[model samples]
Target: MLLKNERISEIVDGKRVIVKKPELLAPAGNLEKLKIAVHYGADAVFIGGQEYSLRANADNFTIEEIREGVEFANQYGAKVYVTANIYAHNENIPGLDDYLRALEDAGVHGIIVADPLIIETARRVAPKLEVHLSTQQSLANWKAVQFWKEEGLERVVLAREVSAEEIRQIKEKVDIEIEAFIHGAMCSAYSGRCVLSNHMTARDSNRGGCCQSCRWDYDLYQLSDDGREIPLFSENDAPFAMSAKDLNLIRAIPAMIELGVDSLKIEGRMKSIHYVATVVSVYRKVIDAYCADPDHFTIREEWVRELDKCANRETASSFFEGFPDYTNHMYGTHSRKTTHEFAGLVLDYDRETGIATIQQRNHFKPGDEVEFFGPEIENFTQVIEKIWDEDGNELDAARHPLQIVKVPVKRPLFPYNMMRKEN
Candidate 1:
């Protein structure tokens, strides 16, 4: 079965035009995150499998789980793609053909790859599965895109360093689908090709062993005339850091749509479920609002605020306008904290008693004020007037993680609804 039609009508230049809305693609690190991504409004989700995936540390999917995830996503009219984007050595090539065939049998919509061997092997052995070139290839020009299109690849995830004008030029010249990162973390290196982790920690970043050595704190030193090293700064100065700010293109949706970008991808496969849900939901609203009525669309402050609650680092519109400057890079050891924390997820609700069953994620006590939100409901805040456990015993707090609790609520809530509290 095909996914839902994403094309919508918009009035452009006094003409009614039908535009293909960009797919809101989200990251699914595991099965739970996959469900959350679809529930919160992702048009599609990309996940890492157990082998040949870039995120070696993530709890990736098994072939069976990939099948189950495909079944779940199809019910919601969404698509699932598997990531086999790791740069391959000879040792990684033996069983890849079988794995590709297995993914094709598991009903995966496509496979994202960066290596020539895997691409050729997929085309030869697993021709049913669509192949998308990963951003690790760093295709920044129209000629590179044309080369890939000639090779029969369906899509090319443009390098993050590609500017808006470059994207426009590529669309003008190339006929392949274009995918770009719309939100999430940024690599300090070009298109995530970095050797800092391999040099510092003996982990090959291109082969799924990145240790994020660039984000670590490092002390700056100066060599003295006596051939001794001296600290560059006093005790009060923070250690130097080279982490790039996270990407936030909440305001760039309209322009990307006009450029005919096929997909807007969120970049964290190992992120938390709350982060996946919040980011996907925010972008979903933005894309829909802009596509529904381009002439009257405006960026909403609440959308930005909702995104701010889930961010762990400061965000920037990196490389979208042009080359980034000093403001795009984080130079000191500073961490960002959000104002809200995920507290619980709704499991079930009883309309007669006006009570909702919740699975506690963080801590929440009776009388605490919290906001509840869902895919189909407007956010509403209400005090936790009463709490009970699964056994119907009253409780003072839902302090334990994943604890099943019942709470009285003023409004009806559905499954997958999330609740958050002030930090």
Candidate 2:
């Protein structure tokens, strides 16, 4: 049950893009999202404990829940890495040690750590633990990577600013694992070492509570002739230059895998379960195909098709695939395309009736064509001609949330298929 497996043959290319399939390391803010990541095709999942990590505001797991989550991830054959990558105050050291002991007891696969003192402490305290340097440590060159390797860090999650070529150089220079971010929201500041969020609010983003004041359109405060403040974007036409675009590396997976990157991370601890399902599924198919046939691999249009199921701004390759157009939108929102309506949730399929039970998410009128996305094989759609409620009474449409309904089918569907349609 490998969510994403890519073994590569060495292709000599300093200029040509030759890559192996990078592991799809998805984020899991909670158990539901973790299930989605594993079901779709995440090789590994990184989650936050109560503290000592970014994304503290996410539906982060408590120690018990984290242990349960790690064991649950193993059932699907995915590795779980708890993020202990905080810039710690001296007082928090004892608390951090407790969390590490808990993770070790839980049998976690690894830990993503940032601070030098923390890494040193982790090596001395949890000798069996594998430490992955967080990008906040800023391993920009081969020397820094070598330094980490000598210090006993097994893997380095490279900074987002590192280019593909630099990644190749690092891979060539060292035996340590190099994991890079492939997709998700981009931080305007370097690899999220910013204090702006915490500066504005008493909540510290470094300790995991980000207010996200960066997203608001703040008016410039300047004195007019009358000493009154005025909006700049309204009159003089200078917009607030704060927000950045979310990273999207879907088109460049083939090349990235060839670079020998051990993991391809998706940055979204604060994202939806729908996003976890849709994006991971798309990458799963392409990575599967690439493994089977690297040279003959093709990016199907269906990948782009199913991608519209969630809301996203215009995508950029980030710094990994290539140089980005700096003015892109990397921040995430609840915006989804209106082209299709999410009709219903798929319940178990009836072997006897050849009908699937669905708890409706939206209305579906009769004779309307629909698309079906499962936990797997999501990009492919199976159309249903007729719709009905649980009573076996035919209905023109289903218009309620969580309304139990039935959809007749010729072929058998699975346990977690989603039913959708064009408006």
lDDT against the true structure, each candidate: 0.90, 0.75
Question: Where's the lowest-lDDT run of ten residues in candidate 1?
Answer: 1-10
| lDDT digits (tens) for residues 1-423 of candidate 2 | 011243365354532223455678999999878877887779899988787878777878887887788778889889999898878878777766667777888888888998877787776667667899998877789889988888878899888889989987887777788888877776766755787777787876666666766665555667899988765556655456556666777778877777777888888888776677777787777777776667777888877666655535556676775666644643234233546666766777887988888888777766767777765443445556777877888887787778898888666677656667776
**In model 1, how large is the Cα lDDT of residue 387?**
88
lDDT of 2 at 189: 65
Measured by lDDT, the strongest candidate is 1
What is candidate 1's CA lDDT for residue 346?
A: 95
Best by TM-score, which number? 1
Global Cα lDDT for candidate 1: 0.90
Tell me the spans in candidate 1 whose CA falls farther than 4 Å from its real position.
1-18, 219-239
Residue-level lDDT of model 1, residues 163-271, one tens digit each, is 8899988887878899999999988777556888889899989988998887888899999999999999889987777778999999998889877889999999989
